[model samples]
Target chain A: MFASIMYKEWLKIRWTYLGGAVLGVFIVFEIFLNLGQIIEFNKANSVWNYIIFQKYLFYSDFQFLPAFIGLIVGIAQYFPEIQDKRLKLHLHLPMRENNLLLSMVAIGTVLLIIIYSFLLIGLSLVTLIYFPYEILVSLLNTVLPWIVAGFVIYFIAAALFIEIRWARRILIGVIAFAFVSMFYYYMGYDSFNKAIPVFTIIALSLSLLILLSGYRFKRGTK
Target chain B: MLVKTSRNILILFVIFVLAIFVPDFYWKIFEKNIRAPFVLYSPVIHDFIISKFDDKTMVRMDNEGNLLTRDEYEELEPLFFYRQIVMTGKMPDSLDGMEIDIQELRRNNFSYRIKPDAIEEPFIQLYPLLESKSGRAKLEMPDEFIRLQNRCEFINCESNEVVEDLSETFSKAFTDIGFKFPAAKIFGNPTTRKPFDEGYFITDSAGDLFHLKRVKNKPYLKKVNRPNGVNVKYIVVTENERREFYAILVSEASKIYLISYNDYEFINTPIEDYDYRVHELMMRGNILYRSFTFSSDDMIRMVVTDREYNKIDQYDEEWISRENTSAGKFSKMVFPFTLSIIDAKEPFINFYFLFSDTRALIGIFISLIIAVILYLRKKIKLKFIWIDYIVILLTGIFGLIAVLLVRYEE
Candidate 1:
């Protein structure tokens, strides 16, 4: 049943998932090219000093790509389900309603994890070309929260789309925005190192929220 | 059951967002700005002079509470305002009964400040090892940088490869001095703007301090003797032309010391009560005296000493901090706790939850009553919705908003 549900979701979002992967890799490649150009014009040691002391991020261009991809993939997967009240028909299957809703979100989450992990490896290789493992660690620490935000956005999108009422949807949207923005509140490199665990838990917990919206949709609540 | 748990999670998430933002906006609308006066000790008057903003005007006063004009205030601290006094041709012939030479005053005047944010900031471990004796007219940055991990490895920038010969020489020198591998903390001002390079003051894995510099393309390594019972926390290296000290050492116990050039002696500054994590330390030096001031948001303390580091005079004053203001007290009655992720003391994004005093009981009590009234208005029995009341009792206004927005269904 889970495999069938996963395939159904894949059919709904296959194009979006592939396009997001391409865009993500292209952005990472652009960041790598920009760093090479920056090192070409300036003395490499001076560039390294600026990045070290001034907290300049060479890969800042990749900051918002994950969130953007998550947003699009989420909308692609869930928007059609609500277009003609299609979810009402899908929920009548033999599986439990909660499992059906949670399984849908779990599919999206797994896909995002695969993409985020691949992009992280690509970024690490680029960072190591000119810098050391120490810098790569800080880069990972800094980018971890942003990746979690991508997952949170995806989860919230599912909840928002599946919700039955506009007022509740707007409420959830506002709260989700405020919650997700916390992940990008950067002070410096590796600023979110200590908060990543708590934030990741919160981000994962938001996946359960789709069940409440699904319940409301099932009952046809106002 | 799954639906109920999901609903509760949503409510809790709403409460978390409100706890961080609502009180944050409240303070933004009603916060008071109170600044401490800048205090300085005068060599001529033998007392402290204070300059503060009184409304829209600048007010200058002495420690004895005598008001003075701006020029009179400047004349009192001749050593501090020497440029203005010299331009006005009112420079004193002498101060503290010693003849004052303008050149000596200019050379000896220095000021350095240490803020908690700067001390606790995130920094990359790469450091530039500039040539101390390049014999050039101006200092230039080298083409390589050093990473002191298991060993001191200098990586050439253009090739991104380890310079094996230089690395071997420096690593051997470091190991010969009983220095442990894998440095713990390294501090230095790696810029060509400085007059010279003091290289880096690094702590090894064993927590012992070592000074490493490159002179004539060779390593000059020295193992510094730290004061017994003092563990090093941070060191701010100053490559000043007047190199009386190598760096300012902050001990793990929050005590401040100067790594003096005189046989690497540790000169303790007369700041008996200072926590470098919360208070800011500012040091000013002139030919005759060194002044140390450490202050927080609402309190200021100034200690003046002779050039030989004896505390000759001191001044201390404190006013009501923002948390004690009227608006602050009223906020406690409205918000049970406030949440923030950023701190002025540290450069990190971590939760900083500031809980209110017992006065917050008023807010919680009022929220519970509101929740009960809300349940009654919806024609719901209060006994069935007892968990909603408990949420209100704990989170106060934030929980009230969440419950109202995300009520349980029958």
Candidate 2:
């Protein structure tokens, strides 16, 4: 039953996921080219100095890609379920309503993790071309919150879309905006290192919020 | 049961967001910018002169609370405003039985400032080990930079490969001096804009201080014997032309010291109750006196000493900080605690909570009353929604707003 549900969710978002993967690669490639050009135009040592002392981020172009992909994948998966009450039909299957709702969120989260992992690996490879292992580690630390924000947004979309009332949906949306903006407050490299664990836990907890919205939907809440 | 848990989580999340944003918004409307006066010691008058902005005008006064004209203030601080004093032809030939030379004054005049943010901010660990004596007119950055991890490794910036020969030579040199591997903290200027290079001052895993420099493509390592019982916290290397001191050191005990060029002696400056984590320390030097000024949010302390580091005079003053002002007092009465994710002292993003005093209980009590009225108006049973009341009692206005927005059905 879980496999069938996963397949159904995957079918709904397969094109969007593939598109996000391509865009992620394209942005990473652009970063690669820009870094090579920067190194060529200036001395390599000065590039390192600029990145180190001046706090320049070589992969800033990839900052918002995950959030954008998360939003789009979220909308792609959930927007259709609400049109013509398609979720009402899906909930009638021979499974627990909470499991049915959570399975959808679980599939979206796993897909986002896959795409985010691919992008991180690509970024690591590009960073290694000019920098050392330490730079790669800091880069990962710096982007961990951004990746978590992707999950947060995806989970919020699941809740917001399935919610039966406009006022509650807007409330969820405003709160989600407030919560997600915290992840993008960039102070410097690895500024989010200490907060990543807290952010990840909060983001993971948000996934269960969809069950409340699903319960409202099941009860025909106005 | 799962739905109820989810709903409670939603309420807690909203409370968290409100706690951070509500106080921030309140401060945005009522915040005040209070500028501290810039105080300088005068050699001629032998008193501290103060200059500050007051009601869109600059006010100059002496420590004795006597107002002075602009020219009079300039004349009083000839050593500090030498250009203005000399331009006005009021520069004295000699103040303390020595001939005044512009060149000497220019060389002796220096200002060094260290803030809590600069001390705690994040930066890449990699540093360029410039050649101290490249014999070139202009200093050039070295082809490689050093990373002091488990061992000293120098990787060429262009090739991104470790120079095994140079790495081993420096690694062996580090071992020869009984320096441990894996440095805990490395401090250096790391710029070619300075007059010279003083390499890096590294603290080993055992907290021993070691100075490493590259002169003529070789390693010069020195294990500094810090004063016993002094644990070094931060070092600001000054590669100045005066050569009087190598760097300024702040110890873990909040004591400040100068690493004098004379046999690497630790000259302790007479500064009392200085916590480097919260204060801004500014050191100014002239030919006759060295002034150490450190200030926190509401107080400023200036200690003037002779060239021998003897205490000459001191100035201390306090003003009401923003949090202590009338608006601040009202805010305390209204907010149980203020939450912030960014702090000026640390680079990491984490929750910084400032819990208000007993006055906040007034706000919490009012918030509890509002929540009770709200629940009664909505016809919600108190027994089924007891947690909401507890949250309101604890978090005050933030919890009231959260529970209201995320209404629970009984």
Candidate 3:
């Protein structure tokens, strides 16, 4: 039953997932072009150059792509199910309501991982060509923090959908705006600002707490 | 219905208010503890001193061990105000052998103190002296030009007797152009290498104690001693203002040899329109190793070598000779602002002034654009309300400004 539900979710969002993968590749390619231009024009020599380039590459685009895509895909994933009362149909199924929500979260997570993986692969290839061997190790270290931030955004979106009913759209929009703005303000310009990361970690932690708390089963018919 | 709606609105408003105010409060607390005003003041003074001195100055050290004076030092006395600010706290125990305590003088709750050590006495003394003398006279003096000589000597002495000895030596060096110099700190050993036939050689002024050998009629570096002393074979000094400086070459025969000052002039050899092979040979030899090359037009090209020159299989020709070719160019561009807010807990008023750089402004612009576009798109679709826009814009502006303040500063 879980397999079928997960498969159904996958089938529903396959096109969006594929589009995200392609977008990831395009973004990585653009980043490579910018990095190459910088290298060519400036003639960078030190290993730190590649590390800094990778840091900016992730800072400029990686977080935005996931949150932007996640909000759009996340809202669309649930909008039809909620509006058509198809979620009510799921209540009649032998599986628990928690399973349905978990399945949706699982599917969204899998898709995001796939897209992010594509970006990583593209970045790796470009970095291999342009940078020295030392840069590969630094780039790997640089991307780890972004990867953590991406997961935080993904899970927060999932939790928000479950908690808010009529105002889910509004809440999601607000959350998305707030999240992206906070990321830009804290990580982008103020990367040296130590508080920004602390705040982000706190926000993610709270979101996770709320998600875990919101997991109780609910009976059908208001 | 109205009351319920107002209550919900009030709750949301409160959350929003707390969100903005809480972070500012936290930043204030953080700033109070971390930002050391004294430490910050030190670098500023250091930079000011270095800039006024033209980055590098040739210190004339007489055989009697006194650094010569420069006229420019006296003219720059007024600029030492920043250094005074750095030395404001509890006085460091020593300052050029003068025993002094900087006790804060308080009258009516106002306190201030200036310890003698706070002012680097050597630099302080030299500043006024340099101002009174002509540049020619300053250059000629053997006691005045030693780089950081007075400060180093002053700080090393333990007893008043030692301090007196240092002071007498310094005063004699200061007054006499040629004093049978006192004992000086020898940077490295002056011993010569092998091959007794290689003529009389003296160690270079730069004081690198490495041994050099001629292989296939070319000087190649080989490691002789490790874990004990550095093995510096070929010493090259290239002056930006002049084409020549003295270098000491150590041959395999443990004999010190002096390469004429003119031999170091290969650094200024105009590479423009020159044979590529000549450039390559100059780069390969210890003559021009790790030196920057400049064209007649002032385009700078820095030659970099890996730890083992063997790691570089091929050199990027365009990268090596391109205009404005120094590696620091990119680093400078990317990190435009060296000022960073050391403490995040400072109040917004205190922190805002710190974001006074072009790079921070650019970051704020990018972040705002992203927030506004996201907020507007959601609003148009009736997916989000206007409040979202307000929250995002405020967060974007404040967050960026805050970040710039905390992270961007050196």
**Candidate 1 — which residues are off by over 4 angstroms?**
B382-384
- Clash counts for the predictions, in order: 0, 0, 50
How would you order the candidates by TM-score, starting with the best? 2, 1, 3
TM-score of 2: 0.98
Report the C-alpha lDDT of model 1 over A2-73, residue by residue, as the tens digit: 999999999999999999999999998998999999999999988888888888988899889889889999
User: Which whole-number lDDT from 0 to 100 does residue B151 have in model 1?
Assistant: 90
Which of 1 and 3 is ahead in DockQ?
A: 1
lDDT of 1 at B368: 88
| Candidates by DockQ, descending order | 2, 1, 3
**Per-residue accuracy of model 2 over B1-410 as CA lDDT, tens digit each:** 88998999999899889889988999899987778888999999898999887857899999988899998888988989998888888889998887899889878999999898777777778889999999987789899999888678999999999999989989998999988778888999888898888899899989999889999989999999899999988999988899999999999998999998887889998989899999999999999999999998799999999998899999998988989999899999888998999887766789989999999999999999988887889888778899999988889989989988988855
**lDDT score of residue A110 within candidate 3:** 74
Cα deviation in Å at residue A97, candidate 1?
1.2
TM-score each candidate.
Answer: 0.97, 0.98, 0.37
Model 1's lDDT to the true fold?
0.90
Residue B155, model 3: lDDT of: 19
RMSD, one per candidate, in order: 1.5, 1.3, 25.0
Residues B194-215 of candidate 3: C-alpha lDDT, one tens digit per residue: 1111211112233323222222
